[model samples]
Target chain A: MAKKEWEKRIAFLGPEGTFTELATKELFPNDWTIPFKSIPECIEAVDAGQVDLAVVPVENALEGSVPLTIDYLFHEADLFISAEVLTPIEQNLMVHKNNVEKYEEIESVYSHPHALAQCHKYLYYHFKSVPLSQSSSTAAAAQFVAENPELCVAAIANVAAAEQYDLQIVQKNIHDFHFNHTRFFVLSKRNDRIERDEDKQQIKTTLMIKLPSDRSGALHQVLSVFAWRQINLSKIESRPLKTGLGDYFFIVELLEDENAPLMRGAMEELRTLGCSVKSLGSYYTYHQK
Target chain B: MAKKEWEKRIAFLGPEGTFTELATKELFPNDWTIPFKSIPECIEAVDAGQVDLAVVPVENALEGSVPLTIDYLFHEADLFISAEVLTPIEQNLMVHKNNVEKYEEIESVYSHPHALAQCHKYLYYHFKSVPLSQSSSTAAAAQFVAENPELCVAAIANVAAAEQYDLQIVQKNIHDFHFNHTRFFVLSKRNDRIERDEDKQQIKTTLMIKLPSDRSGALHQVLSVFAWRQINLSKIESRPLKTGLGDYFFIVELLEDENAPLMRGAMEELRTLGCSVKSLGSYYTYHQK
Candidate 1:
């Protein structure tokens, strides 16, 4: 295989072991992966020429679209979605190996609040009446369990976090959903001119739209344009306009390109509906090897 | 003042000085407010009869909606929204009094990822080059800064956290949006029955609907019911169904109770559109005294 370009540093939201970090590694293998503090910072870094690209989670299979990601896109119209990747999620119940006995006598489970919530059913099924210890994140929870070996405590985290902390996996894949995956968008300050192969399948474009009011059929009027053109819409969501007076905004993903005639017609119809829409970007989904 | 008859025990998601704790206390005065690791656990305690009520965030004025709150509601359908409270979100940049000189030569700012993002403009305008350190929550970040006073570090957190940690406020109200407020839902397992008074200004109900397919005007057909009845919709969001093939699920909120004759007529018309609709509950908004 030919060598890939490596000067492009891919920035992500993280501190060593967040799911974003894992997704970064999976997406750009050769590029340098640097973790920023927040999604806006990551996007700003890309905007200010500090980094070549950034990757952030747009939506989750179990939870929904991340509001931060949506708001950042709607507010700052500079960043664009270059590509999309989905990462499968797996959560583990972990404890320090030194306290193997404590596992059997576990009185409470400690984890990042979200991790604990995701695996709530499993914990309740096993330890029906035990108290839960909530930590900031899985890594912190694992670190806590690692230090407090004398206590009967368990942590729910990813297996990678467990390995990094030198903890043993007490249980595995404890999330309520079987196929939990997080959808991530790869963003770059300069769009990479990657040529599409003949085998490229489905195409999707995401846009943010602000309607006149919360009037009924307003959204329908916007969707009908795509319907008339026979273009399928993959997703539609409403977010607060943040302009006060109970105004609303919508983010939509259409299975068509910006230049497509049908999409152009849809934009015209959306304008007549008195909706202000901005195109985020169009990209093809990447399949895992 | 006469004391209320029900001495409900309420559990909130927090350590001690989290904003959630503050909101919970304000929502239920003269009642017990216990701290829990997570919302799910807190809600579970209420379900198990250990606590009489729980407080969880449903949305934020600036950040849109909290996905975990929505997903938890979908999973735990038995609980109903008893009341909704809006708390103004004011984030402070806090640090040890002795660390003032170090801030000029500071290396990093520690805080929850959300806090960091909300105050992004301030960070970029002033401490743009400094690294950001992500902790689990703002309270945890404050605690970390308190314990390591010698380090050239600061934290973004609420005023209560700063007070509890004995840290001085370096900056105040550093949020990107001045009207930042989080809307919390007071949940109860008792019953949905509530004595309505004419004094109550507005009541909102949330619904999740799964559409038939990706056909043209699919959503329009569903929304026409509300348009015909002139019912106002507060919010609507769509998430992937995660069934491998491209399918989506939509969540909607109405500004009125669907049980009322006019609203019920609108809902009946919506059901005729042939879709799966799930009701969350009708709740009265909490006004500050």
Candidate 2:
């Protein structure tokens, strides 16, 4: 295969047919994408300059944050989040084409643990006694079912997975709750300007902050810095520092741009109080309709 | 078996050999316990009067909060947390006794997803090419390996599981970090006084707060109620209300008792601000030494 000059090389978390692939295609429709085995691998690919950008999931509305992505970005990588893609997660119950008629005889169900968890109610109602197995990813689960047609197994994955693996969608949108969305981050070594439709795009700035060890009510003070400045925080989460129990660094997403003076002043004030603040990125979000 | 006069019928998240069982035994050393398949079942057992109390894991140092326990506590059950137990978590790799010499040839590793994730580095280094499977719990994984001795499989579980399932420990303390602890909550219908050695016991109060929807910086204001009063908060986390994205209710743990004037004042102020505040419990923590 020859490289197309206009198409950029992108990396995503995948074995293909995963939600990350959908997000990657949405962000770079014509580009060549390389699928890595894990979120860290995709990030490392971008950090090592093997790809122009890496698209990886950061948070899901129902399941909450993907700690591995946040922790890696904060502790290891020097990459910047150039853009974000918010896509509604639709988990479908799929099976090999041969077993589509024997859906009631599904001996086991397979998916990534999170996907299995998201469709808990549907699984309980339909396949109450069926063994639920975990695979490395939803795509892997679909691939497994596709390869083993003799086994009466079903997988919960995206519709794209069904198409990729030649599986049948027995049930669609089987996730328990509505308004379920996953936020994916587009990462690059440099904060490159992304070319996208300007309409309906919203800018958000993310910061990782570590409070002073000796101070009491330090988190309250950190929030105070923003509260007094009238800056609204879209999200605030604390992840373990891995040093010990009760030691955490917060990932705060602000509803403003990185260049905003108020945000900069707040970070400065936090630093003055011995809090270590790092800007993750100020990026625009593309919402999937 | 007939119920012993003094033995309390307690329910735990278990199939026998799980961390929850250990916590249950620590809290009620001589009580009779019934194992439930999942966290919700354990809570429901207590709520339905099938058991006197339910012991469930609420948080882990490495994994953060157990959202199922917290969500079920807030959304469904009317139970109150009567006591808390802090236990050190030690993950071990075990295999059937017959495969002690064949450990290197193990084809797959099985455990609860969290356990497998906690030992990420160890698994990557030692069994790089092996497939990892998920069981309902670590105990179930050990039991599976014990039952399927014809297959070379290893399980990541606790020492208790190794003894219960008649397996050999291939590796000890396989978890990546030290000081890994899981906090368990003992739930009962009433706020009963727990009998224990009071030495080294710490009193803590937990509150679940839903901020006014119309206000910006509402979390900061909620924290401000305690900040000016000099009350300290040990932990603050937000779990989804499950209504939609970006809608969350904060779970704040205070380093004060429910009866403390400052704590009560803060709750009152929050209510005045149109915030719905619910006191989950005020309990004493017993640390396993």
Candidate 3:
């Protein structure tokens, strides 16, 4: 197990207790895990062959898409999505246990911006005028609360973060909605390098396509190719082409067989209609264990 | 002049010198300008009849979208787009200027996350590993740099902020792209109170539509209604409905007349096709003066 695990080195955006790390542990429990400071760094590690895969959050429920991850995947990194992991984002108000009853005495709280935004209502009603500080990640916020004995400072992080840092969760499941979750993509140098046996559950293919900006019904035509073939779409969203306002590329996710030949035909048809398509990857989704 | 100005009170997300404030000044040059802390707070002020209009950024070239502002306008705030302001996002690296020659002496820098993101390349190359901190706004970061003169710190803000806080601009226009700009929506409580005169130069109609999730070919049908009408879309993007995964609301912008009867027909058609449509607003785009 040790020898096999040594070869399957996975990199994730982390410092431990992060959602990415938590998701990584669920999917690759026996594999070796390394932590990278940023999403770019994590993907770059995988691209450079320093690690076998990179797991990073692609989108969240309330916060919309994770721009840095999507942008890096699109323009910066030359990696493909090997697999995807969906994790329930449960943020908690964690504090040092020594001052457990000091809710009234708490002066400020810390969290990542998206976490803070997700738990906005809870923070507003409970903390009121309490100043909220931002950290790079939720685990970093938890680490701050753990390292500092400051009773007035608390952190909005996950249950794992509380346990990892030995902090007490003052409030549990503080996110605004119960359905809040984040989707993460596991990245690798090559799409088919991983064995297809274990991940035979279901495949979802993601593609980025540039639609003819000025053409009327361009998006409809792009979708018509799928709709006519009875291909069901799980998700579709557009992002700016970065050249100017109003110009965009569509990112669509299709829950289909990994090697569906229909997708290739669709791409060819789209190109004939002056659309450019790039397949992000074809992979299966993993839920938290 | 003062009497007219006093009657036209405007609220913007601010600690002063934010892009919202700058855009507000550009459009409402003579109007009384007030500052609110959060996006919701600013919009709420407009909804509660506290201000005439609220100026908040809805999207940026690099950031993709400001989900909070868009979501609030969609679900929470009963506001309409009175005007749209486009501002060039010029991020400047500012410092106290006491230690003139000591680049290594700069210990930390502060800015809003988006501001920091806009200047990512510059920060990475120049600051190296210098700690980057987050504040509520770019101007608030400038204020932090101004107040904490003893600390070896810099800030990523705008020229207006640097002047407002009396900080020295160490480097200007640090953002990676030259065409980086944010689109600000002037939110108003009364949807049709503002006259269609000065804003009549151009009209861009924005709408939010909910497509029946389980129905096959639902979105393709929605686009067909507009496509056949020769109604071209300027921008289109999907955001999570936040109820569950795979549930989303499409926000589409069309370049047409403010009172185009074709839109009414399109809305009726969309409703028949099982889509709930809500008009965000119609207004002209504001460019940097």
Candidate 4:
């Protein structure tokens, strides 16, 4: 049910060699994937029809949700997630190829803040006197290090980024844990459901729900609907509504195939509670080796 | 009663003029306040007894919990929260006073990423072509602009920060939402129960909960105890366990003073459910005029 050739262009968070780019390459290895500096820009490009799809990291195994991605999809972007891709992440510290004693001579480290957080333990001990400068993305930092050629300046990115920028790795696997991974949402203007083989591809339906205000036990009742219906919830995220201190809205991902009958029933039950629901989309989550 | 004529030291998110520093100044005007680069460093210094108290931002009405602050308190720090300060935020864009033709000469804008996000509308419409750079703190950005004297660089901070950094306010009230307020926690190594007037100062108990893996509706049940006990929850935050995808631990703040008998029973009930609970501390929330 898939074609071999198409002039489809995808946009990912990058300059190059970001985890989003890795996910994009895994899913559409033959398609052209461009990089955007920001998540909103990448998404808006898809909505404006400049790209066939926007690959953006939505969640991390270690860091929970990426706030920018979640906020964009929930309140700003009109695009839908056509697919989700998960990539195992390995963060490395790379420096200019000409630099000798990279780690010993480093005065400052550059990376996306999230990357810095992931490598906190390493950075705190290793770069004791160094300041961590923020970059737009990990790859962008690598690109900067490649261009600057400073022994005192280094970046925490990926192996692909090292290759892309022709930088040399001073340290490998600098991330906190070995089980690090990130989930990327393939956003598209058209969210038509694709035919899936049941066992081969499992469908996941992600929805954003605004819990009814001024009600006690509203959230409990909302969860009860799915719990009683035996709909397995893969994830539930509560974000501030911003109206007040206690207000919150939840985003849930239900593990089910397309047009899941029980999910529809749960949605109906949620509506009865006056909860507003937006279906992010139903798609086969792509699992990469 | 606390002593009147002693040297009190306070640590805050710094290098100066940050909202946390403002909270610190408001709470301890006559005391010595120092700036630490990160929340962990500030809190750690307090825990290590280097400082009497650490003022850190815990929650924002608009953006929800500060993950670094929450996670640091929950998993790492052994400190107790002594007071909560709520400050209505006013984000201002500031630049060097000598700079002229600000908008046309802009190359890169600077601020804490959250500040940039808060003023998205203003930044997008005004500096569409300019790239947004992240700084350690909004005040740090303002200080950078003040020191650099670069016509292209500006920062989003508060009026207090603008004055401290000797930067001119380019725009006032640039924050998207006027109701935005951040809740700051004044953390101390000592969790002493101070006598409260109750009428003037409300007691707030914050706890961390780890739901049992064996129980399906453990969280719902946990809420039921609160809902039944009529203990109001001021906030609920879920952070990653960092073990795997879909694993989380929740931090909740109950709108009640320390050692409420009903909350004790609720904690016992939670223990029966095999859920682990830790009381971070109960304190009278401080409000600044």
Top-lDDT structure, candidate number: 2
Question: Can you list the residue pairs that collide in candidate 4?
Answer: none
Candidates arranged by DockQ, highest first: 2, 3, 4, 1
How much lDDT does candidate 3 score?
0.84
Q: Write the per-residue lDDT of candidate 1 for residues A127-223, one digit (tens) a residue.
A: 7788888875666777788888787788887766787778899777878877777778888655442234643657788888888665566766676
Candidate 2: tens digits of C-alpha lDDT, residues A1-289: 6779998999999989999999888878899998998899999998898899999999888767787898899888998889898888899999999999999899999999989999999999988989999998999999999999999999999988999999999999999887898889999998764757663466788899999994778999999999888888888888777766677889898888778898888888999999999887788888776
True-structure lDDT of candidate 1: 0.76
Q: lDDT per prediction?
A: 0.76, 0.88, 0.84, 0.82
Evaluated with TM-score, which candidate comes out highest? 2
Please give the lDDT score at residue A124 for candidate 3: 86
Q: How good is the docking of model 4, as DockQ?
A: 0.53
Give the worst 10-residue stretch by lDDT in candidate 3 chain A: A192-201
Which of the CAPRI classes, incorrect, acceptable, medium or high, describes model 3? medium
Q: What is the lDDT of residue B289 in candidate 4?
A: 61
lDDT of 3 at A249: 80
> Residues B12-92, candidate 4, lDDT per residue (tens digit)?
988889898888887788888889988899999998999899999988877777878877887788888887888888898
DockQ of each candidate relative to the true complex: 0.29, 0.60, 0.60, 0.53
Chain A TM per candidate, in order of listing: 0.85, 0.94, 0.90, 0.89
Q: Considering summed lDDT, which 10 consecutive residues are worst modelled in model 3 chain B?
A: B192-201
